[model samples]
Structures are given as structure tokens and as C-alpha cells.
Target: MRFNKSIISISYMLLFFQISISILGTNNYIVSIPYLKYYFDIIVLFATISCILSFFSQTIAVKELVFIVLWLVVSAITLVTTKDILVVTNALMIISARKFSIKKTVQTVFFANLFSLTTTLILFILGFVSDNNNGTVNKHSFGLSHPNQLGAVLMVLILCSAYLFIHASKNIKFILVILNIFYLLLLNSSGSRGAILASLLMFFVLILFYTKPNYLYSICLLIGVFFFCFSLYSTSTSVYASGSILNKLDTVLTNRVRMNNVFMTNYGIKIFGQQVLYTGGSSIMYHADYAYLDNGYLRNLINFGISYSLLFYIYLISVIRKVNSLNLYSAYIIIIPMLVYGFVEEGFTSFLTNIVLLFTSILFISNEKERE
Candidate 1:
């Protein structure tokens, strides 16, 4: 796969900005940078326009064109209703990368995240950035705004590393093992049960990919679908009723079920989207009360609307199917765990944090080729 050099550079720039902003944006210190918010907006705007112009220079298949038009229209509506530009920007970034090599794109994202995480850690170690304890002695945020944020970033990095190790290096299994051990230690230190479980699940999937290749695709699909449905069901039940089982599950999820219930009760689901102020974790320092919806499925439904949430899920299923057909097990392996993690973490919604979201372009591009 070949791309114009200028297009490739622009895409890398966009990826770097998105990854850096998403990772560092969670840092209490980075957020304090003067005009940082405006800088992000300007970068996004520039990238969006550059991506659109680049698309015009390429020959898009009819089916691909239709998909892009429909997606952009929906994203525009989501932007207007949700007041979140990340959705539209994410869509554009994926569209822009349709012609680029998936391996190159994944490598770019992996290195970008690696750099961002390293820089943040160094700052934290130097005492330039303060770690958030959230009034807990056992949990540490590692210079992030919250402990979960640290775990979530590590989870993303691990997923990326796993993909690269599997697809890009045949001799790195030992290194991968060491990395997983290190990740487990960090996750334990942060007390992020969700990330810990998700990372373990990812490791299990990777082992299954080698030990039970035939069952890999089906199992992954089932896990993703089951968790997504479970997320919806748990959130709904938490809002209306409670039971011993529900209480135990809520306790295990650190009261996320109850918090989601609070958000759902206050602001019902919307078809378009609505603005909801989230406060909890480090946010409690400013707000008197604590409230936050950590479930990605519910968060998208409440913040981006049912339409966007449904379409996003449908798109994910489609990508899984397409990648399975293409024998892209690396992508499949990375995506499924992220899907499961979404049940407990909201970062799964962002393309920057969840690189699997960018794999949507592969589905469209492959479809176009098949048509040809």
C-alpha cells in the first residue's frame, strides 16, 4: 500500500496530536498549560481540513463514497447534538487513512503513544507533575488526573504493543511476556481492577489465537457482543432495581453501576445527544458531589445519543467480520479486549485511546477492492 508522502506526513501529525492530547489530556499538569485547549482545537481543525482535501485527491469507490457520506452526515449530527468534536474528528481521521497501510498506521500510533506515555512518566518522576491519590493510599494516578486514567493508558499501550509484537516481530514473545508482567504491576499499583481484568483477558485472547486459532474469531465476537449487551442490561437494572448479585457486581466494578444509574436517572437516553456534566475521581476536588458514568456503552448512548451508539456498535461488529474474513487476527485480537474493557471504561469511545476504531477504514477499503 502506497500513499502520497504529504498525506502520510499529515496523517502522522494528526495521529500524534490525537494520541498526545488524549494521553496527556488526562494529566493534571498538562491540562493547566495556557491556551492548550485552543491549541487542540486548532490542530483538530487543521487536520480535518487537510484530511478532507486529501480525500478529494484520491479516487473513492462508489460504495466507499456512499459510506463516507452517510458516516460524515451522522457524525455531523452527533457533533451538533453532543457538542463533541472528537466524534467527527475521529471519523475524518479514519477516512483519511483508508489508503494507508494498516501496519504503518498501527506502528505510528504505537510509537506516538509510547512517546506520550514516556514523557508523562518522566515528568511525574521529576516532580513536575503531581500524582492524584484521590484520597486513597493504595491507589496512585502516576501523574494522571485519576488512577483509572493511568491504568487505561497502560492498557492501550499494552494492546498496541501486543499487536505489534504479534504481527511485526516473530521473535518478541519473550519481550511481550515481560511487558505484560510490568503492565500487571502498574495496574495493581493503580488499583484499576477493570484494566487489570481487561489486560488479562487480552493476554488470554492472544494465547488462544496461537493455541486455538479456529475458535479465536468466534470467541472474540461472542465476548464483545456479550459484554456490550451486559453493559446495557447492568446499567438498566442498576437504575431501576437492585439485588444481591447486582450489589456484588457493582462492588466489584467500584460502584460504576450505581454511578451509571445516577446519570441515567437524571438524564435519560437521547436519540441525538445531550450535554451532561461528569464529576468524580479527581473532579470531586472542584465539585462537592461525586458522579461519573464509566460504562463506555452507556456513556456513548447518553452523551452521543442512541443513534451514534448503535451505529458505532454496528460498525465495530462489521469491522470484526471484515477483519476475520481478511485473516487479520492481530486487529481482531486488539479489538475484542477493548470492546470488553468498554463495559467498564469510557476511553473506549475515543479513537485516540482505542486504535481499533481506526480499523474501520480497513473495512471500507477492503469492500471497495472487492467491488472492483
Candidate 2:
């Protein structure tokens, strides 16, 4: 028997973001290979391989049909790596914890994190794996950029998995708080300013400034946003949009300004995948000042085109719209995090972790059955 169409469509769209990176990683940045490409390049490669291995072994989850549709689109435009497809395929399996047992839910989230986090930590350890007389800058193995981002991602997953486990298995808020403190610190320390800021933004906008906020909350939120944006305006844009912005405020508004300029100028919008038209630089100099907006909407418009950007936003916002008025905290867990973290890290743009999120979300959200 066929499954629900809504689930299929949502899942497929979620997968579309990953399809872009198959051509080249580094977010289209000019990657200078130290030895191999960077560790993240390898991570994506591994994700694709792992995903493909799962498929051949018949361990592939039966994804929503829309996933097939999205896959076709991916195959048509970009080289849909086996690894990338496999990552989405993992989400296709309708995961549930033995008839809604919280224990199962906690374990599922935790075990999943264990696999990803262990891999990430290994990458971290491997950074110092080599013996080099000169400080040649291991740019790839472990650096300020890739591994740190991966580590931050794993850290967030660790906290979230712990949250799910604590509540599901034993209902311990204290443990959740302590772990969350560590998560926040790791998020900030990982140098992923986006992840750190996004988490705070999620907590602020979704939790504090959500609706009719009390006066104190409103004042506090405004102050926070003002100070945050102020700081981002002061530093650098590349880091904020590419990484995280909260702790550093590092350079978000500049990125947004550039994007806003692009949108203001019609030439910035690309219908098909054309880098020249959007990035506003000569082909030769493209790599010199090549930068994408830290803002999510801007990045889409710049890379994939404005139309794709709109579609992506619509799809993401749908999660909120669908969950609206449902009063589901589980749903809030994902929604809040995406909104917060998305500002900097491109959480939605990331592959393996995002699949875990989208799959887990649909499990509890009401929208899965809406168009069934």
C-alpha cells in the first residue's frame, strides 16, 4: 500500500538542500587541499558512502515517494552522490519507538548521536594524528573551520539526545540543564558563532519573544537583539553567516547587507545555476572575494537563485505553520533550534544531522497526516 503524500513531499524538499553540495563541498569556496581535501570533504564522502552501503544491503528505509521525486531532481541537476542519497534514505525509514514509548524515543536519538558524535570526536583526535616538524597548518584534518563545525554539531546533538533521553527515560530536568550548559559552552568554544548565536536566537525568539511577551521579556529580547546585531556589524560577515554569530556577533549584518544589496539589484537573482550573475564578480576574481551571505535566505538566493530561496523558506516555514496552535513542545524542540541555529550555521543545509531532525520531527508533528 502507498503511504501519505505529505510526508513524501516534505522529506523530499528537505533533501534538496544537500543536492547542491555534491558538485563540490566548501560551500563553493576555493578549497586548497592540504593532503586530501578537508576532513569535512571526507565527512561528506563518508556520509554518501555510508548512505549507499545502507541502500545496497537492503537496510535502506522506505522513504516517502516525494523523496524519489526530489531524488530525480537531484540526479538531474547535480551528481547525486551515493552517500548523499543514502543519508536521506536513512530518514525514509518510518522510525518509531515501539508504539510511542518515551524510552524508545530517547534511546533512538541517543544511539544515533553516539554514532555521529563518535565519528566527529575521532576526526577531532585525528587532527593531531600526524607528526609535522614545521607548523604546516593541517588545514583539513582538524582546523578552525571544518572539524570545529562538525564538533559543534555533534555537541548540539549530544545535548539534544541527552534531553530526549532524560525526559523519555527518567524525566530529569536537572541533568538536561547541566548538559545544556556544556552544550552552550561547546557551541561557543567550537568557534561556530552561528551555532552559538542561533541557539540563543532560538531560545529568544521562539521562547521569549514568541508572541505577546511580557514587558520584561520584550525589553530583554530587544536589548539582546540590538546588542547582538551591533556586534555582528562590527566584526566580519563571512564567519557569522558561515559559522555562528551570537558569541562573536562576528559579521552577520554585513553579510545581510550584501545580500540585501543583491536582492535590491535584480541582476543578483539567478534563475538557473549561474555563479557569475549572482556573486557579482569576474570569473577570475570569484575566488578572491567569493563569499556567501550569512543569512539563510540570502545564501539560497546567491547560490541556487531567489526562486529556490523562496521555495526553501516556504517549505521550512510550513513546519511552523503546520505545528502552529498544536502546543507541541517536541515540535518546538526542532522549530526553535532551526530558527535559532539557522541564522548562522545553515543547520537546514547540513545533511546527516538534518535528516535526523526532519525524520524525528514528522514522527510527532501533525502535518505528516494532514495531506494523507
Residue 65, candidate 2: Cα error in Å is: 5.5
**lDDT for each residue of candidate 1 in 1-372, tens digit (9 for 90 to 100):** 235556666766777777777667657684378755575586577558656755754677897787678768888899997788877876776667665566666777877766776888899998878888778899998887788888887787787778777865556767766866877787788887777777777878888777876676798788887887777677555433456566778877767777766677678889878888886545542232557778888888888888778778887888788777877777766787888888888888877677777775567654433311
Over all chains combined, what TM-score does candidate 2 have? 0.52
Whole-model alpha-carbon lDDT for candidate 2? 0.39
**Total clashes in model 2, counting residue pairs 3 or more apart in sequence or in different chains:** 13
Candidate 1 wrongly placed segments (more than 4 Å): 1-5, 30-32, 46-50, 170-177, 237-243, 281-288, 366-372
Local distance difference test values of all predictions, in order: 0.74, 0.39
> What would the per-residue lDDT of candidate 2 be over residues 258-293, giving only the tens digit for each residue?
433333243344553233233424334323243434
**Whose lDDT is greatest here?**
1
TM-score list, all predictions: 0.88, 0.52
Highest TM-score, which number?
1
- The alpha-carbon deviation from the true structure for residue 268 of candidate 1, after best TM-score superposition, in angstroms, is 2.1
